[model samples]
Target: MHRTPCTVHGTDDRDVTTVCRCGCGEALPAAPAGGGRAPLYASPACRQRAHRRRRPVAPTTPADPPSVAPLLAQVRELAAVLDAGGRPDPTGVRVVEDLTGRLLARARSRGQTRWLPWVDAAGRERTALDDGDVEALTARLYADGARTVGPPQPSRPACARWVQAWRRDTSPGAQTYAPLELVPGYPLTEVDARVLVQGCRDGGESWASIAARAGVPVAEARTRWG
Candidate 1:
């Protein structure tokens, strides 16, 4: 290849000129007199470097490590939103929960923990809750033996499942199952409680027994049962 510029004598004329893309301040050689695609690199080494830079990167697996502080902070924010909403946002909660679950699972697989300080609502600095706590909370959101009654849907909390069970058991001509009474100190909806009390009476269970089981006086049970 000719290394000299092909310029007419006594004239400042050139075919083409361009800069290299690799941050190296070098001019690419001019193309021939007839028009053609200009070179993108000053040398073969720069061309090879540019090619390597554009190669596809492999997809990352779930076990990839993440920054601990930001992940924890994100989890805390999600938890705070759940708390402040008073009504749960299941999707947001699940997102952070799954993120933390994967992080902890990866740590456990390597037989180590990534320790970071976390502050609780009581303003005490402590380690994050263990898998057991998450398990317990997760269990509380689902009733044992609950199954889909319709097409696929998002998960419902255990309370929702309980209420569904209660409604089905109390419906006229509906097959009965074990009762899922309301939690103490928080009565079921007025209608659900009424149905429950009436169902008990119709089942030949005495008002006194029903009252005792419900942690209420017999008179209150009779009044509600009507």
Candidate 2:
């Protein structure tokens, strides 16, 4: 871990080995880097000992956890059935089982495994996803470890963005919201402008930045809006 690549065989070179690296000075086969890097440590113990001497390089940016929204939704549906004192519908149960298996296989392919959720929820042999297993998967996906018997709470679904309005009144007289691209002299209003600005903020746009683009100073913008 600490020692540099074998001066003779660097990482880019194939099938060659470096020294014991712990300075053991033995000629062992390089670590099992198929065609990648020349091996560095001789054995697990050697690598670990080197690790203790100094930290090994930090790992790369980790992969994001796989989204199991469909699986989570199915689990919730089944849970509702169980709560109602009725056996889970056989079709729905099968769907959850199949979805879980597919998600596990997909995650394995991507090397994005956290292991505990898949292991505990459905195990290697594929059992039904129980409450605890559901919670485990929920925590993994949502990062809220304390939630028990609760489903994962992800952000507002992207479909919300496509919906023209969340307000209740759709009557023509109700003054529906303006589109993002507002044309000049479209009978626009101060209230309408404020609504649009606030909606933009709610949608994660920064008013300060938008104002800056229009050559408005931050202080002046805030004075009018805030």
Candidate 3:
């Protein structure tokens, strides 16, 4: 669609002339013998310039957060579980940690990196993550000291004792890795009984009742399950 030309007053203010929409302040000649709408610009260059100016800018949609977002969210959720003294599936934690680390490394790599290995290995379908998401995840993961992978430090004597107790109380295959040793001066919390509550949920246990039994909020229990 083209714009209809606006008429402007001739030099004597007694006649009318077509004003170029290009703002050149020049008058346009009559449209060719055919009766049609007049052109807007004096020359092709002006028409091109007008077209460029009138072109609709592509609307700026915010980029989606990286595919690592859900993974990082899982990391935060797992960290919360540990913080709350809930024992997580060892295999699950290891898988999440490795995936998060690889994602972080790939984001910083100049070379190509396989993204979200777990998603691929699980044979589950997922939406592809874009460059924007990776950049965002990298910044956030690096900022969060708790999530960043660090060098392994020798377990403190207290942490060691806590681990021994944990082993004694836990049944075979119930325990995975030891609790994080990041809290040096703080006493370790025994794995809460709620850790086993997820099992009961499948046995027709009410969510409210399971949460009460676990001594954790229902939301926390759901987060743990996720």
Candidate 4:
């Protein structure tokens, strides 16, 4: 390690003592009337203090650059598009929005819900609709004795009251079994309200999920809408 000694042109500089090259701030002998080489340091100790050698740091290897495979693939796709000798669809903005919505989900309120999109065994993406695919699935599950559908247990550790909790094969074919909602007091509802029925159906709840939440047979949930 090595360090260069700090120097300042101390000749005729009035503030040389205050701005000492070695940071000592001690006064120096006044420069001779004849201009000459200036004092380089305020004192011998200051000279040693100002000339500390800095340790050499080891050089770090640069990070590897991003892989080029994706970029090359995108360029090849663009070349094929150019070879087609036509511009892409002018109306394809809608497709971009659709794909973006599928790829990036927006934040939703607790009260809001969206329909379930599933990829069946056939590898095609499809939206699950109530009263149709939903009903068919529920009928199949109910017949299979998936009676483990019911309201959530009370949040408190110990309850004087007991509520039946769904505890069985809640698997993929039946979709996810998220406990419908936390019904604090008790599960009470207008037994046969048309608006209520319509609202529940439109709320993206499959009959299977609704039945499990209502603690009823999935068949009963399906027939209730019928």
lDDT of each: 0.50, 0.47, 0.47, 0.43
lDDT by residue (tens digit), candidate 1, 23-46: 465677777689888787899999
- The segments of candidate 3 whose C-alpha lies over 4 angstroms from its true place after superposition are 1-16, 29-38, 61-97, 100-183, 188-226
Better of 3 and 4 by lDDT: 3
Inter-residue clash pairs, candidate 2? 31-39
Please state every model's RMSD to the true fold in angstroms. 22.3, 26.0, 20.4, 19.1
Rank candidates, lDDT, best first.
Answer: 1, 3, 2, 4
Give the distance in Å from residue 166's predicted Cα in candidate 4 to where it truly belongs: 5.7
Compared with the true structure, the alpha-carbon lDDT of candidate 4 equals: 0.43
What is the Cα-based lDDT of residue 102 in candidate 1?
49
Please give the ranking of all candidate structures by TM-score, highest first, separated by commas: 3, 1, 4, 2
* Candidate 4 per-residue C-alpha lDDT over 106-203 given as tens digits, one digit per residue, 9 for 90 to 100: 21212323222233344454454343244455443344333223347323222212211221223225533222231222343434322334455544
TM-score, prediction 2: 0.21
Candidate 2 displacement at residue 131 in angstroms: 55
